[model samples]
Target: MSVALEVKNTYEDFILEKDILYFRVGEHGLVSFHGKNYHIKKRLNTEEIQKMTSDSSFFKVNTDCYVNTRKIQHIGDGKVYFEVRGSESKYTTITKLRQHRLKEIVLQQKGEA
Candidate 1:
């Protein structure tokens, strides 16, 4: 589960508003978002991650990292599966559980399931 909140930023007497969003998990995980590395204190199962990435707003750039799909540059698959765009490099390979979940997500996203 995750909590969604609103955020307000002020700079030079100017105020900017944004959403304060976070994902919840039992253990912490590593992620890279918008060129910055983030330590996700919440741990989530592969199925949850897959569901999250199914949304257009999110993308599974790697097995351990789910990025915003809008940020993806390109996707490649082979012995070394990866996604690279600009300064971002994401790995898509993972354990069997994650791999299976990823495949399900992909199929769901493509409307094949």
Candidate 2:
């Protein structure tokens, strides 16, 4: 079973760490799960959310987005791919600076380190 990370939002619900694809900073933090986006309570930013979801599976992909590595279908050619609901796939390009870090994490996860 995936570990559950409780995040208090307007709905006051718990979100599974594995179900989270990414978190982005907007007016409030937006936590993406599958195809849905949840507004994280006003106080938390992507960095705080990262701390809350602290695990090897989560990493900051850019200045505004933090991605869950476990949710990644693949990462290459500067794109980070994620599996969503149906026929559609979601992808976000990583910054050149952070791309190398993400690749390291992916390799470490695969026990290739």
Candidate 3:
């Protein structure tokens, strides 16, 4: 299978996509990617990072990335590009099985699903 560039491990151990909205996956957590290259660093996991969202804006876009739908610029190339709050060029890929559900969630957030 051909993985998308957005899914590449650019941040070593950190999985970064959203600049503001995020979630936890394992022993560590994602803070937020920033600056020109959208480089991200590791952060101590916090309760806030794992908080459950009951709204349409926040959902899991990938295995370790939960995003606010409003932060997305577009979805294509098996990935989700973001017009995020901090970073300039960070994106994430949804699992193939979840892609359709992601579309439904995105559209539902806009009342178009």
Candidate 4:
């Protein structure tokens, strides 16, 4: 479930609608889709983003990140991991503390299916 978001930087506002794999905590708030990360210029944070996108298939995997569960290839070691756009061996992770919630979300979705 790719989502379209409006994000702003120091200079401009940009539309970022992509097949977001995951968001990693970084210098600019969150790093995402195909390495196209952005800090929302005091517009939004991780929690806000989660709330905004949850019904569209985003989940707060941990404190430091939110992930599009549909893109998750694996979850482990307090992290949710997935493939990047053009990489085989390379993947990304977001910190996960109470990892069981991830399982529950998957299970719940599967039940729906």
- The best candidate in terms of TM-score: 2
TM-score of each: 0.30, 0.61, 0.53, 0.49
Winner by TM-score between candidate 4 and candidate 3: 3
- Give the runs in model 1 whose Cα sits over 4 Å from its true position: 1-31, 34-64, 67-92
* Candidate 4 regions with alpha-carbon error over 4 angstroms: 1-18, 24-56, 84-96
Say which prediction, candidate 1 or candidate 4, comes out ahead on lDDT: 4
Candidates arranged by lDDT, highest first: 2, 3, 4, 1
Q: Considering TM-score, where higher is better, how would the candidates rank from best to worst? A: 2, 3, 4, 1
| Comparison by lDDT, 2 against 3, better one | 2
lDDT of 2 by residue, 1-113 (tens): 89999665534454546446766655566544332344343456778666655655667777667777776777878878886555566777788788888888887777853
Candidate 4, after superposition: displacement of residue 5 in Å? 24
**Per-residue lDDT for 102 in model 2?**
88
TM-score between model 2 and native: 0.61
Kindly list the per-residue Cα lDDT of model 3 for residues 19-110, writing each as its tens digit: 34444344456555332255454565576455433444576766565666766667776777665555555677777776678777777667
Q: Rate the local accuracy (lDDT) of all candidates.
A: 0.38, 0.66, 0.57, 0.54
What are the per-residue Cα lDDT tens digits for candidate 4 across 1-113? 99989654423433333444555445554444332342333345778555545645767655555566666666666655565454553344544445677767867777787
Full-model lDDT, candidate 3: 0.57
Q: Can you give the lDDT of residue 84 in candidate 2?
A: 52
